[model samples]
Target: MSESLVQAIASNQPELNVEMLEDIEIEKLGEGNAATTKEKENEKSKKRKTGAPAERIALCKYIILDELPFKAAEKEGFKIFVAEICPMFQISSGYTSGGCKREFSVSPRLTDIVGKSIGELLVDVVTQWLLPRLFSCTLDNAAANDVAMRHVHSKLNARNILATNGQYLHQRCVSHIINLVVEGLEDIGMSVIRGREAVKWINASPSRSRSFKDIAKIAKVDTSKFLCMDVPTRWNLTYLMLEAALPYEPAMRLFQTMNPYFASDLKERNHRKMSIGVPTELDWIEVKRMCGFLEQFYNLTHLVFGSHYFTSHQVLMELCDMIGLITDLEEDEDDGFRNMVMRLRLKLGKYWLEETKLNPKMNKILYIAIMLDPDPRQKMKHVEYCLKLVYGSTWANELLE
Candidate 1:
């Protein structure tokens, strides 16, 4: 809505549907239902459809750290442990192949006593559990496509990305797996990276089959050793499937090669980036799936992101630019960074209401693309005396498969 209308509502126009926040609603009782209802009503019946699992999922739509597993603070031996958290914790849940909702949580306990904060811990989890799992699977269909993978992984760097699981989760989730190596080479500790690179080269090469035997012999490793595992199963995305993988020389070679700069970079003080303004409702299962998908590509993710050529932030900016959201990319390249609140003034006759379309899918794409915008906090607002022909409210949450 327009700032003027918001101001008016906040001022003397209380009847215009503005209510000041006087209290916090810890219970998610009457919230989001209207968005849900409106979403169901407005979502057009399209030809495209995806998998629909039968299991019940508890989408964390919106949660607070206070609502997490830990209660207040605990008395550990000599100290009282407390959750040092930001103001919000937003997440989501979706059904798996078997109808199970997979929600995720990094080892806050692991990161806590271990020193890092929860957000950092989630990143580490993505490195370990998430990336590893991605390597264990193969991309086959539209559901298992590479382009989709790229969309998901690049989003990791967003501000507040850790707090929610919006549609962005599926964007390039597969590509994120492929990008693992890009992420790893920045740290030089991995000897296995080279071998894995060889595997990737072979898989990605024209003469892959012919070079396979020779590649294994030169690396003194054998891919044949990985026979017992079911190859690329779905859960492999979660477990990282390393247990099923033959840890022989062949497998070792593929897993060892990583970035030297990464280790050194890891030792350096971490520079924190701002959170993206989009809200999410992420789940542990998707996190696990994200982990499984990232395995081999963990180092790659580091590499892609580390390159001075193009940062994750830049990529997202390009996306937003394509949608005409980021104007004048050549001059003020950083305009996408502010909180964008699109102010809408639909001029019409006295008794008529103006209608507008806020397609959820387009909104999602815009939201993800905005993360890459040069500005981290850009938001939009629309102003109207009345929302005509619209569902219920200007703000809504839509669920799609």
Candidate 2:
């Protein structure tokens, strides 16, 4: 009946076609819902695809800022966490993290890194950034840095941007200066050499390390405190090595007694130098003395390198303590120890003593820092006393003047 009605309508109204009638019937029956569902699906797909890039960028930032290892992203636990929170994000590999590090690294061109070039770059940065005031620049003991600092001092002085005509513009790195002082006593005596060789012999192989651990246990020594080898160039590490080895001295002696091969092996390695064979009673005594001497330097180095504390004000007090330490140790009866202390004293004086021609004149800032300190113990009188103890009263008065 509907078909017949449609035919009658088409015949009565020639403009209206059967196809147009079919479309109107389909819309009424809700067959267009399929197209609407497809559109929603497409919108959801677009959102999912776009979310991944943002999540990846966040992951990259997390890795970079937290200083996490590249493999951290690919770990099973991390991947599972990422999947739970962001299913669309794919975890990257270590290689990808390394690539990101390289891309983000900022460094000056290495082709021309001379003092003049360095000064120019620094001036450019200071000008572009428009810093209100330029103060000191701490640098290690390097000839090139000396030249660069002079150039910077001149530039800032010409602009009238520096106080005191840039006299305190070059601050020597205290840690580096300490290193130089300690390094001056590198070859203290054969006792240190034998002690180092003993440690090296113990840590040469896994078998030897385990044997030492077992011996330490038998000697009732704390096995948790393991022996460590020191880098020759790093005095702090050497101090640590000696400190760690002191507790194991009993174990070391017991092992030496049990295994004569220990001394024999070291002797062979040292080409039969009897002095470098094995640590003796005298060697242990000297080592203990050396450890005590180096402790101050180790502590000062840590204090100087602390990032969360203001160390400038404390440097003068610490330097006074160091000078006193060296002075006290200078009276040791042992010729070798006295010689070592003398060498360190000479080196310290070279850099710190006001009367010495080799002294860098930039240490006035240190005195200034101590004078400004709010500590009751660090008043002007105390500074004067410290200077008098280090330099003579005449030089101290001159410095104050």
Candidate 3:
């Protein structure tokens, strides 16, 4: 705060005792005075430790460096590029009657990712664009990223820029890890295959879609919603397909009986083979159950995808909630769901262990974020309790200490 603002505040508080006013004045004057040798040394140490300018120190605390990758299909051959990645930041302006207030902003930086290697490209970006501005980098769990981060640390060490000892420099992307866990679950079982085939067939051609609509009308079922095609890479699309198709189970079954061509088309297009097998009543029930199960994950993903606000601090709590749900579902009466949850639980456990290996500085920053959150006062005691529950007293105590 400026000295003028401090004086104004002190002047407005007439009831302020002489001692309080004197202290405030003294502090303001101290800020205006020249720095002592010891104070200069301490400031330099802090600057080196954080790799941030004194002016930018507060703003860099929660900034994130990420890469948004895209394929350059326009070219003759396949080429991938890290098209753009925006840095997101939040800064508190001043204290209000209610509390402190902050403004959020995003600045996107675009750079060609083609170079000698991915690590070299990343190192160049870090040095030229991020070095002093970035507090940490959030990245997908890929072996390439591990190599890239190691390269970054090596460069930083060579420059004597030991920001958090280059340990807090790497912040694992929770969303990517969760997507992988869900992918693993999908790989193990073809539980959604029947539902996928049913949707794919009905939505394959206009004639088939019209036939399905007519069947829905004849069966006195709702025809407002249509079946949706799902992309293999995004599981959310599959969840959405299942959700949209569940209500049309009766119509679909009747349509399958009425039209034998539902199993195969006379001609195939786009290398898509004819999809066989309509979803049975039992299969529809399973789809509904899987949708219910996946909704939690979908919601959590939406919550953390936010960039304008704090997210890292909530990662642990969300993981805790997910693990708890997985634990409960692992003992489910439905054998299928129980088995799926078992696979998901294993994946979640593996990622959780990897996340726990984050540097102490990164953990400290996340804890500070949680404590500073306006709506929820995540006190240290509560954080410790959660840690203890998840990682046991020994580990939690060590973290707290």
Q: Best by TM-score, which number? A: 2
| TM-score (C-alpha, index-matched) for candidate 1 | 0.16
Which candidate number would show the highest lDDT if scored against the true structure?
A: 2
Candidate closer to the true structure by TM-score (higher is better), 2 or 3: 2
Clashes of each: 107, 0, 0
- Rank by lDDT, highest first: 2, 3, 1
Q: Estimated TM-score per prediction?
A: 0.16, 0.68, 0.58
Prediction 2 global C-alpha lDDT: 0.80
CA shift of 280, model 3, Å:
2.7
Report the lDDT tens digits of candidate 2 across residue range 1-401.
Answer: 28998898899999989998887778866756877888987776678668777867887898887756566888899988976755665665545356643433332333225666777777778789897678788888665576678788888789987777777888999999999889877566777778888998888677889988888999999646799998766788889899999898899889998888997887776523544688888889889988988999989899999889789998888899999888887898888788888898878877787663335644688988987888888889999999899877988888887
Question: After aligning candidate 1 to the native by TM-score, how far in Å is the CA of 315 from where it should be?
Answer: 4.9
Q: Which model, 1 or 3, shows the larger TM-score?
A: 3
Q: Is candidate 1 or candidate 2 better by lDDT?
A: 2
lDDT of 3 by residue, 1-401 (tens): 46576567768887875667678778977866645756876776665546535424533332322211122223323212212211122123333554211111111111112212666876677777755644567777755566567776777667766576765677767777778888766542344777776777777667778988888999888656678888765887877777788888888779877987764442232223534355667767777878877777887788789989778777767766777778778888978678888888777766564235544223355555566656555767667777776667877787777
